[model samples]
Target: MPVSASYRWSPFCVDGVTTVAVKTLKENAAEVEKKDLLSELEVMKSLDPHVNVVRFLGCCTDKDPIFVIIEYVNRGKLQTYLRNSRAERHYGNTHGKSNILTSGDLTSFMYQVAKGMDYLTSRGIIHRDLAARNILITDDHTCKVADFGFARDVVTSKIYERKSEGKLPIRWMATESLYDNIFSVKSDIWSFGILMWEIVTLGSTPYPGISAADVMRKVRDGYRLEKPEHCRRELYNIMYYCWSSDSNERPTFLEVVQMLDKLLHTEMDYIELERFPDHNYYNIVNLSGEKL
Candidate 1:
């Protein structure tokens, strides 16, 4: 398997007016890579269109470099968006429209992700890797779940075990996944908690300053990430809930959606993204899992 591969942003006007992104595989991609791309295509084709999920446009498999076309998200990765927003605020860049987010904006992002995850779980799909980097942000700030390379269908069996060893998101992984290579909707929920942390921290890499080996040891020892300075206690509590050691204890995506919805409508702000310190420390990290 390739150490790192990303969908190329090849925007073309398919209809001479409407543009789309094409995910192209490398010219010399291995057989396993081709199979993975095909698997991703199958999964995307099976999914129904949802506001919070990236829309699959079409594909081209007859050619040497297979193409998996998808809807174009102008703002790009949510991780990059958040980091840029932080930079904008830090440097007082008022040249154009500000990207500084409000409490409602942040809450809406969390709610959108939960809704997307709910839809995927309903379709019996497990987004093995759920993080900010895998999510895309539209120009309107709508968050959509993207990247299905690690996704699996669990309609028949509720659990999926990894028999092959490869790169894993240890920092965002659940306890069972870390220890036994087991993956399920519950593990995705745990990763969602990490995603929430990323949102609040402006895309800070999880377990910042900690080594991968240390992250595994600490997570196994019942250690959880502390709440961010700008994160509210209530929101932090919700994140903590997602990190429950027992997978069964974690709330379903629907429940998470409900919680976030309620939080969004409430008078009290669950989090204040505008309060993020000017001297922010969060930065985008490699999503290739090579660091791990």
Candidate 2:
């Protein structure tokens, strides 16, 4: 079973102007593995659509080469965008119109991710591979969650269950997830914290000098990634909260949205969110889980 391969068409389109991304099993994948890929695709299709999530247009899994068509994000991966933007910020240091993100822009990214995360958590999905690299950016700077290859329905799980085994992104994972393969919403929140750090630092790699093996030991010993040098203390606090060893204490994605909402207001012009109730907009969802 070939575990790696993908095709991206330079001129792929749905209606001439409507661009899209098409995903399918690696051409070299064994016939036995096709079923696994199709099953996962079906699970992803069951998820309700949301702006924060990469929309799936359709799929064809009836035969040899199953394919799933999804939305095409113009700017590509969030990590790549941040890295390029960061370089541009240093090269010219342009103001007002530079692609460099302001604190306001950072908050916008956080808000969108949280909104999408809230939707996922609400629907019982656990994105085991949540990270900056898994997020796609559009030309308008809209961010969407991508790469659901590791997602599963863990909405009713009281505690994370260790994975049987797979290649996990250890750097962006929580301590429990690392040691036990256990995963849950809290695990996703931990990865979200790392993603936030990436955004604040304009795409600095997480744990620059730490090895995967040492990361588990360090985190278990109360070691957490320090705040990005340019991150505001308030925003850092939220990231810290997400990294709590007691997963039960970590705030739900909804709480994350509310806290980020407050920060966004403080950092820039406040806008009313019609989706949330006006009177109790700050009502945070407190999911019962272990504290990290």
Top lDDT model: 1
lDDT of 2 at 31: 53
Where is the poorest 10-residue window by lDDT in model 2? 283-292
Q: Give the lDDT of residue 214 in candidate 1.
A: 84
Model 2 agreement with the true structure over 1-292: per-residue lDDT tens digits: 0012343223287767897777776666665446546655765787878899888788876675678778878887787787776667557665666675666776789789888888888888888888777788887878898777667766566455754454457768888888777888999999999888777766666776556677768988999988554455778899999999999999999999999888866744322211212221111112122111
Query: What's the lDDT of the predicted structure labeled candidate 2?
Result: 0.72
For all predictions, the C-alpha RMSD in Å is: 2.5, 9.4
lDDT of 1 by residue, 107-171 (tens): 89999999999999999999888988889988888999998878888888978997766677788
Which structure among the candidates has the greatest TM-score? 1
Tell me the RMSD of model 1 versus the true structure.
2.5
- Give the distance in Å from residue 153's predicted Cα in candidate 2 to where it truly belongs: 1.7
